[model samples]
Target: MTIVFISDDAQALACGADAVAAAFEKAGCTVERVSSWGMFWLEPLVEIGGLGYGPVRVEDVEGILTRHAELVSASTPHPSSSATIEAWTLERQSPTVKQVQGDDLCVGSLEHHPFIARQQRHSFARAGKTRPLSLVDYTATGGWTGLDRARSMAPADVVAEVTASGLRGRGGAGFPAGIKWKTVLEAKGTTKYIVCNADEGDSATFADRMMMEGDPFHLLEGMAIAAHAVGAGEGYVYVRSEYPHAIAKLNAAIALAAEKLAPFRVEVRVGAGAYVCGEETSLLNSIEGKRAEVRAKPPLPALEGLFGCPTVVNNVLTLAAIPHIMAEGGASRYAELGMGRSKGTMPIQLAGNIKHGGLFETAFGITLNELIHDIGGGTASGRPVKAVQVGGPLGAYIHPDQFDLPFDYEAYSVADALIGHGGITVFDDSADMGAMARFAFEFCAAESCGKCTPCRIGSTRGVELIDRILGSGKTAPDSVEALPQMHNARKAGRSRDEEFQLLEDLCETMQFGSLCALGGFTPYPVRSALKHWPEDFGQAGSAQ
Candidate 1:
């Protein structure tokens, strides 16, 4: 009888082991259940004779064994039914493994795919390939190189190396990572903390999720480096609850890392599904067990955070890229890859109604058109492209006219948009620009956290005004003229004219007075829709 082992955190270890033993007993084979494979997507993944089989649903175990002839021949079943065993074998030729170097056996290895392979992968090299809980695998791939290098260097040198890389925060803000690290290192504090903001609430972004699932050790290594560099003894990863698999893997990786790496220790904290937690300060407040609300800046997390201690809060990708910067050629090597004011490879996530939905890491300066058409393969609906939302919920909606724009922070800023979290959500020709604009306000209204008046009240007003515009009939001829005049006014420059002044007033309040990006950037989608698709907001009375 063949003995198989499976490791899943959700199931008790002893229970899983007994279940496997019972399955083997029933199959007339020996059973040895160890632990779950790190890949949560393939839970109950069973390993026998160096081969992995899954997703191994509870009810299908008997049929799986019988169908694969495991009871008699001991041959492994194919990874998927769509592909034959021969095809699966061929696919595993360059299989992506995390740490231990072996024949790639998994079909989902990012190393072999063009979408993941073309650009640099300093941080994510070992993600899917390595056993997340194995420090031996992590150390084998030069995992602690950054920590070791950091232990010897002055704090300033560590900061300098990071600065040289030109690494920016992968979070929506796009701030310089090195500068933030330096601030934490320079801050006067007996106790400092390194926090990884893994609350990826953006519906269209999954780079962080993929990184955690594929290469969790890199994240650990990055966190360790930050802890060591800043002399912080403790760190926390505030992962969102939506990512149960990511949270589980990260927790396992953290426990494994703690056992293996002695000097630096990290912990994983789970967040309730609060979109506001994606904000840095809100994340900190959530970590402190408070309502997730945006705090006023000037006392950024760098200076005071998490129980009033000096904290270095960075996005998952930003920290993951650190070890690569230190190990390979330092920051300059990374900085050399991108366009002006935007350096290093950006892991752009193509989600929503796109044919190819996944992460694409490219140097800045790639055009939006290329990202949407060439890499993304256009809309999933197979219809003509209408608009794309760059960034996340708070980002702007850009029409095809803006597709020629280069994808750098400065370039996007010039076009009055911010690339928050590098999410590009494609919309086909059937998309309603007016409805999307309304959604921007609605999202802000739902997630504002009620911290500031402008965000708390203005978003609701924006939605109501949009509804008024959409609901207004011929009785309000002034409203019809006001729509065009309002669109033109925003183009001409900010104005206080009475006709369409309500929306302009709402935009101004949300832009300037809102506490965070949620409120501050609602106008991006609102104004973009008004500018690009003015016809969508034409009088409802006239339209069919």
Candidate 2:
């Protein structure tokens, strides 16, 4: 009996994996629904005897099975009467698998695929290999070893191990994870909480959702280790309501792992789809059944959080890396992987207009040029890469000239950019920087929690001001003749120079005056576009 594996990941399902699976099942083939390999472009991917076939349709199933049957009959010394299938399996698992391309039916083994082969997966090592809810599969792959290791040691010893690992938060802020855990552990509280921020609202980021859906046990184990270190009895995963599939899988995994977790129980909390809830305070508030809004930070969540008790709020990826770190010598091994202050592997999601958009986990020193061109395979449109957004919507728009910049937290900060959540969104030459700049302000305006005036008012006013500047012929020249006539009498003839100044002033105000990152970081894209592509704003010399 030939076994077939198809992805049940949300992206795969959206691309019609369910139909493909049903087609295989109807043909009397042994079918198993597995997690996505994150090779989204070739979704509805099916694997047979270690060979990968993708973008498969219901119509293609018969042809695939027929090809396998032919391979089975032709090969010599076949265990299941399939010599060719055995050869392919050996090739996939072997050190040197034949790398072939341009064949729609077979891309060979995904292990040898350039996209999968090059990545140094740590937190996502078990991503595509196991059944998400299978305890047998999870343990066979060394799942609970980390938790067992953490449980044997003292709580402080567990904290020391994590601190030695040099792991940083993967959720935008590059704060050291061990330090946060230490604070929670040392904080004066009897009941502490571990909150996993899974409210992944970023446009190009899906690693969190993938982790929860693919390897839910990995996340649970990581959280349990954190619980042991911080002396917390309860944990909550605040996932956005938009990720129904991830939420469902997490809930199911929690049920299955109830005994494994013991006193350190886990719960799944759903967000109301508010983008601001991605922030720590907002997420904590949402878990408490309060309105999802950012609370001013003085008493950080590590000391005062979750019903006025001490708490450790780490994102999905941050917690997910814990299991690996807790294994023997895993901390030192993880600490040695990356460059400079940034340590361990980052599960960077390559998205937007890219040829191979998926999760690529590697050390932090890889350059944007290597990621975009060498790894990402350049633009999906096959056009010259114009700009790439290294973070989420709030991240700065990086120009082609800056492609050589290393993908490190401190390096990006010095460059006036950030590797926020490791979500890279690419854009081609056809992208309009002016329109993109306007969209940034518009995004801020629409998603603002409205608790602070700078973000709420500044973003709305930014949209109107950019509209006026765009209409004032700023893209061509600053001359009065080039400017369009205003419809309002109050401001009949405002110069483009004045509007530009107003925009600059507004950006400055938002950057400094805003309470949270929503108001503060909105100026990143706006200013980066204005600085790098001043001609887009029609003011070539106006970038400051």
Q: Using lDDT, give the best candidate's number.
A: 2
TM-score of each: 0.77, 0.93
Off by over 4 Å in 1: 1-112, 472-499, 539-544
- Scanning candidate 2 in windows of ten residues, the lowest lDDT window is 76-85
Candidate 2: residue 440 Cα off by (Å): 0.8
- For residue 534, model 2's alpha carbon misses the true position, in angstroms, by 1.8
lDDT of 1 by residue, 1-544 (tens): 3444455334323234346446656777545433332233344555433345555555556765654353223222333332122333343342322111223232233234445456565555553344555565567767788777776787788888888888888897889988888888888898999999999998688788777765677788888888877878889999999888789889877777785445667888999988889889999999999999888888978889878888999999899888888774667778888899799888887877887665677788999888888877888789999988898877888989889999899999999888988988888999888788888889888888998999999988788777766654222335444676566433322221332467877898889988888888888888877777777876333221
Cα lDDT tens digits, model 2, 127-178, are 6666788787788778999999999999999999999999999999989999
User: Clash number for every model?
Assistant: 16, 2
**Model 2, global lDDT:** 0.87
Clashes of 1: 16
